[model samples]
Target chain A: GAGVSQTPSNKVTEKGKYVELRCDPISGHTALYWYRQSLGQGPEFLIYFQGTGAADDSGLPNDRFFAVRPEGSVSTLKIQRTERGDSAVYLCASSFGLGADTQYFGPGTRLTVL
Target chain B: TQLLEQSPQFLSIQEGENLTVYCNSSSVFSSLQWYRQEPGEGPVLLVTVVTGGEVKKLKRLTFQFGDARKDSSLHITAAQPGDTGLYLCAGALRSNDYKLSFGAGTTVTVRA
Candidate 1:
Protein backbone atom coordinates (compact mmCIF):
# COMPACT_ATOMS: atom_id res chain seq x y z
CA GLY A 1 0.00 0.00 0.00
CA ALA A 2 1.14 3.52 -0.68
CA GLY A 3 2.21 5.45 2.42
CA VAL A 4 1.89 9.17 3.02
CA SER A 5 3.71 11.38 0.53
CA GLN A 6 4.84 15.02 0.75
CA THR A 7 5.83 17.23 -2.13
CA PRO A 8 8.72 19.63 -2.59
CA SER A 9 11.04 17.63 -0.36
CA ASN A 10 13.01 20.80 0.19
CA LYS A 11 12.11 24.46 -0.15
CA VAL A 12 14.24 27.56 0.38
CA THR A 13 12.74 31.04 0.56
CA GLU A 14 13.79 34.46 1.72
CA LYS A 15 12.26 36.00 4.82
CA GLY A 16 8.89 37.72 4.46
CA LYS A 17 7.92 35.33 1.66
CA TYR A 18 5.10 32.84 1.52
CA VAL A 19 5.31 29.09 1.07
CA GLU A 20 2.98 26.17 0.84
CA LEU A 21 3.73 22.53 1.63
CA ARG A 22 1.58 19.70 0.39
CA CYS A 23 0.72 16.34 1.92
CA ASP A 24 -0.97 13.29 0.47
CA PRO A 25 -2.23 10.95 3.11
CA ILE A 26 -2.81 7.26 2.67
CA SER A 27 -5.88 6.18 0.80
CA GLY A 28 -8.93 5.96 3.06
CA HIS A 29 -7.36 7.84 5.95
CA THR A 30 -9.82 10.16 7.68
CA ALA A 31 -7.44 12.05 9.93
CA LEU A 32 -4.48 14.26 9.09
CA TYR A 33 -1.95 16.16 11.15
CA TRP A 34 0.91 18.58 10.66
CA TYR A 35 3.96 19.13 12.83
CA ARG A 36 7.16 21.14 12.87
CA GLN A 37 10.59 19.95 13.92
CA SER A 38 13.48 22.26 14.68
CA LEU A 39 17.06 21.12 14.63
CA GLY A 40 17.98 18.89 17.59
CA GLN A 41 14.40 18.88 18.86
CA GLY A 42 11.43 16.60 18.56
CA PRO A 43 8.43 17.36 16.37
CA GLU A 44 5.90 19.82 17.74
CA PHE A 45 2.25 19.61 16.82
CA LEU A 46 0.83 22.19 14.46
CA ILE A 47 -2.69 21.37 13.35
CA TYR A 48 -4.98 18.41 12.84
CA PHE A 49 -7.89 17.69 10.55
CA GLN A 50 -10.67 15.20 10.96
CA GLY A 51 -12.32 14.68 7.62
CA THR A 52 -12.65 18.09 5.91
CA GLY A 53 -12.73 20.14 9.10
CA ALA A 54 -9.90 20.99 11.40
CA ALA A 55 -10.61 19.24 14.68
CA ASP A 56 -7.63 20.65 16.57
CA ASP A 57 -5.60 23.67 15.64
CA SER A 58 -4.40 24.94 18.97
CA GLY A 59 -0.86 23.93 18.15
CA LEU A 60 -0.64 26.46 15.35
CA PRO A 61 1.86 29.03 16.52
CA ASN A 62 0.03 32.05 15.16
CA ASP A 63 -2.45 33.35 12.65
CA ARG A 64 0.22 33.39 9.98
CA PHE A 65 0.01 29.62 9.77
CA PHE A 66 -2.99 28.01 8.19
CA ALA A 67 -3.92 24.62 6.71
CA VAL A 68 -6.77 23.22 4.70
CA ARG A 69 -8.07 19.81 3.71
CA PRO A 70 -11.28 20.57 1.89
CA GLU A 71 -11.68 17.09 0.39
CA GLY A 72 -10.52 15.23 3.49
CA SER A 73 -7.78 13.56 1.52
CA VAL A 74 -5.05 16.04 0.73
CA SER A 75 -3.75 18.85 2.95
CA THR A 76 -1.71 21.97 2.43
CA LEU A 77 0.15 23.94 5.07
CA LYS A 78 0.53 27.61 4.24
CA ILE A 79 2.81 30.06 5.94
CA GLN A 80 2.49 33.81 5.45
CA ARG A 81 5.34 36.25 5.77
CA THR A 82 7.79 33.61 6.76
CA GLU A 83 10.55 34.38 9.22
CA ARG A 84 13.92 32.76 9.82
CA GLY A 85 12.44 31.34 13.02
CA ASP A 86 9.96 29.46 10.86
CA SER A 87 12.67 27.41 9.19
CA ALA A 88 12.25 23.74 10.03
CA VAL A 89 11.09 20.42 8.72
CA TYR A 90 7.35 20.29 8.21
CA LEU A 91 5.87 16.81 8.63
CA CYS A 92 2.49 15.39 7.77
CA ALA A 93 0.86 12.26 9.14
CA SER A 94 -2.38 10.36 8.80
CA SER A 95 -4.37 7.64 10.50
CA PHE A 96 -7.38 5.50 9.80
CA GLY A 97 -9.22 7.39 12.50
CA LEU A 98 -8.42 9.70 15.35
CA GLY A 99 -7.42 8.63 18.87
CA ALA A 100 -4.92 5.89 19.60
CA ASP A 101 -4.60 4.93 15.93
CA THR A 102 -1.10 4.48 14.67
CA GLN A 103 -0.01 7.49 12.65
CA TYR A 104 1.82 7.01 9.38
CA PHE A 105 4.25 9.82 8.54
CA GLY A 106 5.54 11.21 5.28
CA PRO A 107 9.18 11.91 4.58
CA GLY A 108 8.52 15.61 5.28
CA THR A 109 9.29 18.91 3.52
CA ARG A 110 12.25 20.92 4.75
CA LEU A 111 11.43 24.63 4.70
CA THR A 112 14.31 27.05 5.00
CA VAL A 113 13.62 30.72 5.59
CA LEU A 114 16.75 32.67 4.97
CA THR B 1 1.41 22.00 28.45
CA GLN B 2 2.79 18.61 29.41
CA LEU B 3 6.45 18.12 28.64
CA LEU B 4 8.34 14.88 28.05
CA GLU B 5 11.96 14.71 29.02
CA GLN B 6 14.37 12.18 27.56
CA SER B 7 17.74 11.36 29.08
CA PRO B 8 21.14 11.21 27.41
CA GLN B 9 20.32 13.23 24.34
CA PHE B 10 23.09 11.37 22.51
CA LEU B 11 24.39 7.88 23.02
CA SER B 12 27.03 5.83 21.16
CA ILE B 13 27.51 2.16 21.80
CA GLN B 14 29.26 -0.82 20.20
CA GLU B 15 27.23 -3.35 18.29
CA GLY B 16 25.80 -6.17 20.38
CA GLU B 17 25.55 -3.97 23.44
CA ASN B 18 22.33 -3.19 25.25
CA LEU B 19 20.94 0.31 25.58
CA THR B 20 17.94 1.85 27.22
CA VAL B 21 16.27 5.22 26.74
CA TYR B 22 13.92 6.77 29.24
CA CYS B 23 11.04 9.20 28.80
CA ASN B 24 9.61 10.93 31.84
CA SER B 25 6.96 13.51 32.57
CA SER B 26 5.03 15.07 35.44
CA SER B 27 1.62 14.45 33.92
CA VAL B 28 -0.11 11.15 33.45
CA PHE B 29 -1.10 10.05 29.99
CA SER B 30 -3.58 7.53 28.73
CA SER B 31 -1.15 6.12 26.20
CA LEU B 32 2.49 6.31 25.23
CA GLN B 33 4.07 5.63 21.85
CA TRP B 34 7.61 4.98 20.70
CA TYR B 35 9.00 6.02 17.35
CA ARG B 36 12.27 5.72 15.49
CA GLN B 37 13.51 8.21 12.94
CA GLU B 38 16.48 8.44 10.63
CA PRO B 39 18.15 11.38 9.00
CA GLY B 40 16.01 13.07 6.34
CA GLU B 41 12.97 10.95 7.21
CA GLY B 42 9.92 11.38 9.37
CA PRO B 43 9.46 9.24 12.43
CA VAL B 44 8.26 5.63 12.12
CA LEU B 45 6.05 4.17 14.86
CA LEU B 46 7.65 1.41 16.86
CA VAL B 47 5.13 0.56 19.60
CA THR B 48 2.31 1.96 21.72
CA VAL B 49 1.63 1.27 25.38
CA VAL B 50 -1.72 2.09 26.89
CA THR B 51 -1.71 0.31 30.23
CA GLY B 52 0.26 1.47 33.18
CA GLY B 53 3.08 -0.97 34.02
CA GLU B 54 2.42 -2.83 30.79
CA VAL B 55 5.30 -4.24 28.84
CA LYS B 56 5.44 -4.94 25.14
CA LYS B 57 8.20 -6.67 23.26
CA LEU B 58 9.17 -6.41 19.61
CA LYS B 59 11.98 -8.88 19.02
CA ARG B 60 14.98 -7.49 20.85
CA LEU B 61 13.22 -4.27 21.77
CA THR B 62 11.14 -3.92 24.91
CA PHE B 63 8.82 -1.05 25.86
CA GLN B 64 7.44 -0.50 29.34
CA PHE B 65 5.02 2.11 30.58
CA GLY B 66 5.46 3.39 34.10
CA ASP B 67 3.10 2.32 36.86
CA ALA B 68 1.80 5.87 37.00
CA ARG B 69 1.68 6.36 33.26
CA LYS B 70 3.90 9.40 33.55
CA ASP B 71 7.01 7.69 32.21
CA SER B 72 8.20 4.93 29.90
CA SER B 73 11.35 3.14 28.88
CA LEU B 74 12.65 1.44 25.74
CA HIS B 75 15.26 -1.26 26.06
CA ILE B 76 17.05 -2.88 23.18
CA THR B 77 19.15 -5.97 23.81
CA ALA B 78 22.17 -6.95 21.78
CA ALA B 79 21.66 -4.07 19.41
CA GLN B 80 22.87 -4.19 15.84
CA PRO B 81 24.08 -1.46 13.55
CA GLY B 82 20.67 -1.42 11.93
CA ASP B 83 19.18 -0.33 15.25
CA THR B 84 20.89 3.02 15.20
CA GLY B 85 18.58 5.99 14.91
CA LEU B 86 16.73 8.68 16.88
CA TYR B 87 14.21 7.31 19.38
CA LEU B 88 11.26 9.40 20.41
CA CYS B 89 8.55 8.91 23.02
CA ALA B 90 5.16 10.55 22.81
CA GLY B 91 2.12 10.56 25.03
CA ALA B 92 -1.56 11.24 24.65
CA LEU B 93 -3.11 13.00 27.62
CA ARG B 94 -6.42 11.22 27.17
CA SER B 95 -7.63 8.12 25.43
CA ASN B 96 -9.28 10.21 22.76
CA ASP B 97 -6.64 12.87 22.46
CA TYR B 98 -5.27 13.09 18.94
CA LYS B 99 -2.38 15.32 19.77
CA LEU B 100 0.82 13.93 21.23
CA SER B 101 3.40 15.44 23.54
CA PHE B 102 6.84 14.32 22.47
CA GLY B 103 10.27 14.12 24.05
CA ALA B 104 13.29 15.79 22.55
CA GLY B 105 14.57 12.32 21.56
CA THR B 106 17.64 10.18 22.04
CA THR B 107 20.11 9.71 19.22
CA VAL B 108 21.68 6.26 19.40
CA THR B 109 24.69 5.37 17.33
CA VAL B 110 25.83 1.78 17.10
CA ARG B 111 29.40 1.23 16.01
CA ALA B 112 30.06 -1.97 14.18
Candidate 2:
Protein backbone atom coordinates (compact mmCIF):
# COMPACT_ATOMS: atom_id res chain seq x y z
CA GLY A 1 0.00 0.00 0.00
CA ALA A 2 1.11 3.56 -0.60
CA GLY A 3 2.51 5.33 2.42
CA VAL A 4 2.30 9.01 3.32
CA SER A 5 3.97 11.40 0.94
CA GLN A 6 5.07 15.06 1.10
CA THR A 7 5.76 17.36 -1.79
CA PRO A 8 8.71 19.66 -2.40
CA SER A 9 11.14 17.52 -0.41
CA ASN A 10 13.20 20.64 0.18
CA LYS A 11 12.33 24.32 0.13
CA VAL A 12 14.46 27.40 0.69
CA THR A 13 13.02 30.86 1.19
CA GLU A 14 13.95 34.24 2.60
CA LYS A 15 12.86 35.45 5.98
CA GLY A 16 9.38 37.00 6.17
CA LYS A 17 8.28 34.99 3.14
CA TYR A 18 5.41 32.58 2.99
CA VAL A 19 5.61 28.86 2.29
CA GLU A 20 3.23 25.97 2.02
CA LEU A 21 3.98 22.29 2.56
CA ARG A 22 1.65 19.61 1.32
CA CYS A 23 0.98 16.12 2.67
CA ASP A 24 -0.81 13.15 1.15
CA PRO A 25 -1.83 10.62 3.70
CA ILE A 26 -2.31 6.97 3.02
CA SER A 27 -5.58 6.02 1.43
CA GLY A 28 -8.47 5.66 3.90
CA HIS A 29 -6.64 7.39 6.73
CA THR A 30 -8.96 9.57 8.82
CA ALA A 31 -6.41 11.29 11.01
CA LEU A 32 -3.51 13.54 10.06
CA TYR A 33 -0.78 15.30 12.02
CA TRP A 34 1.99 17.82 11.42
CA TYR A 35 5.28 18.12 13.27
CA ARG A 36 8.51 20.08 13.03
CA GLN A 37 12.00 18.79 13.79
CA SER A 38 15.03 20.95 14.41
CA LEU A 39 18.52 19.70 13.74
CA GLY A 40 19.66 16.98 16.16
CA GLN A 41 16.36 17.08 18.01
CA GLY A 42 13.19 15.06 18.10
CA PRO A 43 10.08 16.16 16.29
CA GLU A 44 7.76 18.68 17.90
CA PHE A 45 4.02 18.44 17.41
CA LEU A 46 2.38 21.18 15.38
CA ILE A 47 -1.25 20.42 14.53
CA TYR A 48 -3.58 17.52 14.02
CA PHE A 49 -6.72 16.92 11.98
CA GLN A 50 -9.46 14.38 12.39
CA GLY A 51 -11.43 14.08 9.20
CA THR A 52 -11.90 17.58 7.75
CA GLY A 53 -11.70 19.43 11.04
CA ALA A 54 -8.70 20.10 13.18
CA ALA A 55 -9.18 18.14 16.37
CA ASP A 56 -6.03 19.38 18.13
CA ASP A 57 -4.02 22.43 17.28
CA SER A 58 -2.53 23.44 20.58
CA GLY A 59 0.88 22.41 19.38
CA LEU A 60 0.95 25.18 16.79
CA PRO A 61 3.60 27.63 17.89
CA ASN A 62 1.72 30.76 16.91
CA ASP A 63 -0.96 32.30 14.76
CA ARG A 64 1.46 32.48 11.87
CA PHE A 65 1.14 28.74 11.41
CA PHE A 66 -2.02 27.28 9.95
CA ALA A 67 -3.13 24.02 8.39
CA VAL A 68 -6.13 22.77 6.47
CA ARG A 69 -7.53 19.42 5.41
CA PRO A 70 -10.80 20.19 3.77
CA GLU A 71 -11.14 16.76 2.14
CA GLY A 72 -9.67 14.80 5.03
CA SER A 73 -7.08 12.94 3.00
CA VAL A 74 -4.76 15.76 2.02
CA SER A 75 -3.32 18.47 4.25
CA THR A 76 -1.37 21.64 3.75
CA LEU A 77 0.71 23.45 6.36
CA LYS A 78 1.07 27.16 5.73
CA ILE A 79 3.50 29.51 7.36
CA GLN A 80 3.11 33.24 7.15
CA ARG A 81 5.98 35.68 7.42
CA THR A 82 8.38 32.89 8.15
CA GLU A 83 11.26 33.58 10.47
CA ARG A 84 14.72 32.06 10.45
CA GLY A 85 13.74 30.25 13.61
CA ASP A 86 11.05 28.42 11.68
CA SER A 87 13.56 26.60 9.55
CA ALA A 88 13.29 22.88 10.12
CA VAL A 89 12.06 19.59 8.66
CA TYR A 90 8.28 19.58 8.47
CA LEU A 91 6.90 16.06 8.82
CA CYS A 92 3.40 14.71 8.23
CA ALA A 93 1.85 11.53 9.56
CA SER A 94 -1.45 9.68 9.42
CA SER A 95 -3.30 6.90 11.15
CA PHE A 96 -6.45 4.82 10.71
CA GLY A 97 -7.97 6.62 13.66
CA LEU A 98 -6.48 8.33 16.69
CA GLY A 99 -4.97 7.33 20.01
CA ALA A 100 -3.24 3.97 20.22
CA ASP A 101 -3.28 3.53 16.45
CA THR A 102 0.13 3.40 14.85
CA GLN A 103 1.04 6.57 12.98
CA TYR A 104 2.98 6.27 9.77
CA PHE A 105 5.21 9.16 8.70
CA GLY A 106 6.31 10.73 5.46
CA PRO A 107 9.82 11.60 4.31
CA GLY A 108 9.20 15.24 5.31
CA THR A 109 9.82 18.58 3.64
CA ARG A 110 12.91 20.47 4.69
CA LEU A 111 12.15 24.18 4.96
CA THR A 112 15.07 26.54 5.16
CA VAL A 113 14.52 30.19 6.00
CA LEU A 114 17.46 32.10 4.66
CA THR B 1 3.83 20.10 29.18
CA GLN B 2 5.14 16.57 29.56
CA LEU B 3 8.81 16.26 28.77
CA LEU B 4 10.68 13.03 27.96
CA GLU B 5 14.38 12.85 28.67
CA GLN B 6 16.66 10.38 26.90
CA SER B 7 20.12 9.46 28.13
CA PRO B 8 23.38 9.26 26.17
CA GLN B 9 22.46 11.59 23.34
CA PHE B 10 24.98 9.79 21.17
CA LEU B 11 26.40 6.26 21.26
CA SER B 12 28.86 4.38 19.10
CA ILE B 13 29.51 0.69 19.44
CA GLN B 14 31.22 -2.05 17.46
CA GLU B 15 29.13 -4.62 15.68
CA GLY B 16 28.13 -7.57 17.87
CA GLU B 17 28.22 -5.40 21.00
CA ASN B 18 25.28 -4.52 23.18
CA LEU B 19 23.82 -1.10 24.00
CA THR B 20 20.94 0.36 25.90
CA VAL B 21 19.03 3.66 25.69
CA TYR B 22 16.83 5.03 28.43
CA CYS B 23 13.89 7.46 28.47
CA ASN B 24 12.31 8.98 31.53
CA SER B 25 9.57 11.47 32.31
CA SER B 26 7.82 12.82 35.37
CA SER B 27 4.39 12.23 33.87
CA VAL B 28 2.68 8.89 33.62
CA PHE B 29 1.49 7.71 30.24
CA SER B 30 -1.10 5.23 29.09
CA SER B 31 1.16 3.98 26.37
CA LEU B 32 4.70 4.37 25.13
CA GLN B 33 6.13 3.68 21.68
CA TRP B 34 9.61 3.33 20.29
CA TYR B 35 10.68 4.40 16.81
CA ARG B 36 13.80 4.18 14.70
CA GLN B 37 14.74 6.81 12.13
CA GLU B 38 17.48 7.07 9.58
CA PRO B 39 18.90 10.06 7.80
CA GLY B 40 16.60 11.65 5.19
CA GLU B 41 13.70 9.40 6.20
CA GLY B 42 10.78 9.50 8.54
CA PRO B 43 10.71 7.48 11.75
CA VAL B 44 9.56 3.88 11.64
CA LEU B 45 7.73 2.29 14.54
CA LEU B 46 9.57 -0.44 16.37
CA VAL B 47 7.26 -1.43 19.20
CA THR B 48 4.59 -0.22 21.62
CA VAL B 49 4.25 -0.95 25.32
CA VAL B 50 1.08 -0.35 27.29
CA THR B 51 1.44 -2.26 30.51
CA GLY B 52 3.72 -1.10 33.26
CA GLY B 53 6.67 -3.42 33.91
CA GLU B 54 5.95 -5.12 30.64
CA VAL B 55 8.64 -6.38 28.32
CA LYS B 56 8.56 -7.05 24.58
CA LYS B 57 11.27 -8.50 22.41
CA LEU B 58 11.98 -8.04 18.74
CA LYS B 59 14.81 -10.16 17.41
CA ARG B 60 17.82 -8.95 19.37
CA LEU B 61 16.06 -5.86 20.67
CA THR B 62 14.12 -5.62 23.90
CA PHE B 63 11.79 -2.89 25.19
CA GLN B 64 10.74 -2.45 28.79
CA PHE B 65 8.26 -0.05 30.35
CA GLY B 66 8.85 1.05 33.92
CA ASP B 67 6.54 -0.14 36.66
CA ALA B 68 5.34 3.44 37.04
CA ARG B 69 4.78 3.95 33.32
CA LYS B 70 6.93 7.09 33.42
CA ASP B 71 10.06 5.55 32.02
CA SER B 72 11.20 2.99 29.45
CA SER B 73 14.35 1.40 28.12
CA LEU B 74 15.48 -0.24 24.89
CA HIS B 75 18.30 -2.72 24.81
CA ILE B 76 19.89 -4.39 21.84
CA THR B 77 22.05 -7.51 22.01
CA ALA B 78 24.76 -8.13 19.45
CA ALA B 79 23.81 -5.10 17.44
CA GLN B 80 24.46 -5.10 13.75
CA PRO B 81 25.38 -2.30 11.40
CA GLY B 82 21.73 -2.07 10.40
CA ASP B 83 20.94 -0.92 13.93
CA THR B 84 22.60 2.44 13.40
CA GLY B 85 20.02 5.23 13.57
CA LEU B 86 18.16 7.57 15.91
CA TYR B 87 15.93 5.93 18.49
CA LEU B 88 12.97 7.91 19.78
CA CYS B 89 10.60 7.32 22.66
CA ALA B 90 7.09 8.78 22.67
CA GLY B 91 4.23 8.61 25.11
CA ALA B 92 0.50 9.27 25.11
CA LEU B 93 -0.92 10.85 28.21
CA ARG B 94 -4.24 9.02 28.00
CA SER B 95 -5.65 6.03 26.21
CA ASN B 96 -7.52 8.28 23.82
CA ASP B 97 -4.91 10.99 23.51
CA TYR B 98 -3.65 11.13 19.95
CA LYS B 99 -0.90 13.57 20.69
CA LEU B 100 2.51 12.10 21.52
CA SER B 101 5.26 13.61 23.62
CA PHE B 102 8.66 12.59 22.30
CA GLY B 103 12.11 12.45 23.81
CA ALA B 104 15.10 14.20 22.26
CA GLY B 105 16.26 10.79 20.99
CA THR B 106 19.51 8.86 21.07
CA THR B 107 21.70 8.58 18.02
CA VAL B 108 23.30 5.14 17.77
CA THR B 109 26.13 4.21 15.46
CA VAL B 110 27.19 0.61 14.96
CA ARG B 111 30.55 0.15 13.39
CA ALA B 112 31.13 -2.98 11.36
Give the per-residue lDDT digits (tens) of candidate 2, residues A2-94: 999998899999999999999999999999999999998898899999999999899999999999998888999999999999999999999
Interface DockQ of candidate 2: 0.84
DockQ for all models = 0.89, 0.84
Chain A: TM-score in each model: 0.98, 0.98
Q: Compared with the true structure, what per-residue lDDT tens digits does model 1 show for residues A15-111?
A: 9999999999999999999999999899999999999999999999999999999899999999999999999999999999978788999999999
| Worst lDDT 10-window in candidate 2 chain B | B1-10
Task: Give Cα-based local distance difference scores for all models.
Answer: 0.95, 0.95
TM-score of each: 0.98, 0.98
Residue B65 displacement in candidate 1 (angstroms):
0.6
In angstroms, give how far residue A62 of model 2 lies from its true place: 0.7
Badly placed stretches (over 4 Å) of model 1 are none
Per candidate, native contacts kept equal 0.87, 0.78
Residue range B41-88, candidate 1, lDDT tens digits? 999999999999999999999999999999999999999999999999
